[model samples]
Target: MTTQFPTPANELDRILTLSDFNVDYSNFDDQFKDLAKLAASVAGTEISLVGLIDSYTQWIISGHGMEIQQTPREETVCQYTIMEEDHLEIENLSMDSRFQEKPFVTKDPNLRYYYGIPLKSEGHNIGTLCLLDRSAKKLAPEKTELLKIIAEEIVNRLKTYKTIELLRHKVTEVTDTKNKVVHDIRGPLGGIIGLAQIISEQGKDNNMDEVLEFINLIHKSGNSILELADEILSAEKKTTVKVKGDELNLRVFREKLEKLYVPQAKIKGIKFTVSISPETETVPFPKNKLLQITGNLISNAIKFTPQGGNVQVNLVLTARENPNVLRISVTDSGSGLTQSQIDNIIEGTSTSTEGTDGEAGYGFGLALVKHLIDGLRGSFNITSDQAGATFEVILPQ
Candidate 1:
């Protein structure tokens, strides 16, 4: 049977999202290889494959008992699997009109049984976790459920992989930004240095007017340095700020924050905790901005705190005022902030400071948080002593 190759209605979107993985068409990752092996074991099949199908190719990312890396989309049974919302199992691929004439079935491999669970991401079926066998057979109900669970695991891994890729890209951006800022600062700095050197040499001449002119130039150069720093930092800010908001479940939000920071803290030998009041359920807020705010606070807490220290995130619903308020706090068991740092934070000009472990700081934490809080018509507070510190945010609902 010669049938037209089936394509999803969201083919363009599906392909675009799939490209985010940047996966090598033939690279068989071991994590996915294990998943394929398990899938095959559960289904009692000779061949199990984890394949991602794109416009014209089915990239066999991982497979058990199969060496073929990829195949033409039209020649692959998985082409039809991605179209369905759930698992697609064909007891006999040779008997199924949709796949009978496919090259893999009619010629090489001569596969007779097929079962595929769609690998879904962002509402699109990007690939499949499939099992194939030479002899016709049916998969048991329990085995099919197990395959579905494995498929979900594959999707979760994909999400985590994509997130890691994004973080790597952001790190690159930050490194480049810092490099550019350092290079650009040299121009004004050189001017100031040259002017000061000239003044020292001319001091013996009692040339008061020339000295004053040099002083003015030096002052202007100093201002230029500050302005340049602000310009570059503001440019970085553009990537983080959001203009829109979403109705987000607070429970999910808290869990996500904990998941993100807990691992980071653990890497530094710090204990991280997130606590939300039981009454808090949902909030109307820009999710990304909230993430940015909390992320910066938690990151600073972890960075400043020494090894074996503690960091915490707290979310509370406050009902004492006319409009209900959402209170979020991040506390760290670390050396308290210096008076100079506190003043800079209050003046919205806080600069980076090294952590206890000598980790280089990312400039502008509390200042940015203050700006975001002001935008939200909220309040930001900080309290610190000889022992530790706590940063609080109060948003009225």
Candidate 2:
């Protein structure tokens, strides 16, 4: 019996627009091309591709060892490979019954070995990063693991590209809003200046009531300008400012955790939890800085933790310390940061890398967190291993 040609679900429509992104990395991006090269080289394969598939075509976005840019979906192995949640590898394609009849096999090149992982991002199966070999072979467990990481890196790059595109769109919107706000401000400013000038010029001989009317008009116009400025400034603040606190301590944290990240964590299958052992209830710390420090750390934790993984937020009192301190910690069961990343982040020399979910972030969040900690006269430390990572902030009471 002839098998049905497999295709991606409805999500294909949303992510298959390869041209819509218009990604340009001269020749090709170092990361994708490098990953492809590394994958093939490590696995001892001759061909590798970073690709996406539509109903009928597999578009090769990046890779090596293939002359053609695309192939018919029905004739491609990726169509079936993409169905797996993690990865799919065929030790020898000719020996596999499901793919034995495939054209890429029976036809020229007669590809014999294959390894690939599905690129799932934002709840959609976007594509695959795959290795192909003319000779039959099987990748060692370690090599297969490397392929998985490379696939994740490719997905992270895609996510970052998409995020940058979104930010570009947002910047355009902000520019338009700024222009509109400036236009609006001019009318009120002009009114205030005109009325003030009129009151000054005609004040000596004019009726007193008429002067008061001019003054009132000027006041209203001034108020209008202030309102506009405040609104613009407030909107700008929301983008970077997590929260503002006055007389804030660990008490506000559990509430903030519930209000801010709990819902987000639930959506991602991250077990977000909080623990608090307050020291004297309320300590004087810059609320904004405290929020920035902890917020960025927790955000990182959640971003790096895979679904069903754990992320913990803990606030502990260290009474034994000379100053009697409060330590806030965020830990995650995800891929940990490298030593280089840790050094760069702490020394303000480098930014962040990709998270497990492929979320794009300015490597600056941790730096900003450190800056905030310093501003608050607090100390912090970060440590990570293959299993996970942790960040801790200690503020004096």
- Residues 1-397, candidate 1: write the lDDT tens digits: 2234476778656765675564434334676888888888999999999998754457787899888665545567788899999988899988888778877788878889999889999899999998999999999899899999999998898887668656765765675679687668878777776667667557668668777677767767776776777777677557433321122346766776775566668767999988887754543333435655676688788878999999989988665566867788999999998777777786777766667776544354565567667867888888898789999998876
What's each prediction's clash count? 0, 1
Residues 21-64, model 2: lDDT tens digits: 43331223355778888878877889989886543346676787
lDDT of 1: 0.74
Q: Please report, as a residue range, the 10-residue window in candidate 2 with the lowest summed lDDT.
A: 18-27
Please identify model 1 stretches exceeding 4 Å from their true place.
1-3, 206-397
Error of 2 at 150 (Å): 1.3
RMSD of each candidate relative to the true structure: 21.9, 17.1
In terms of lDDT, the poorest run of 10 residues in model 1 is: 239-248
lDDT leader: 1
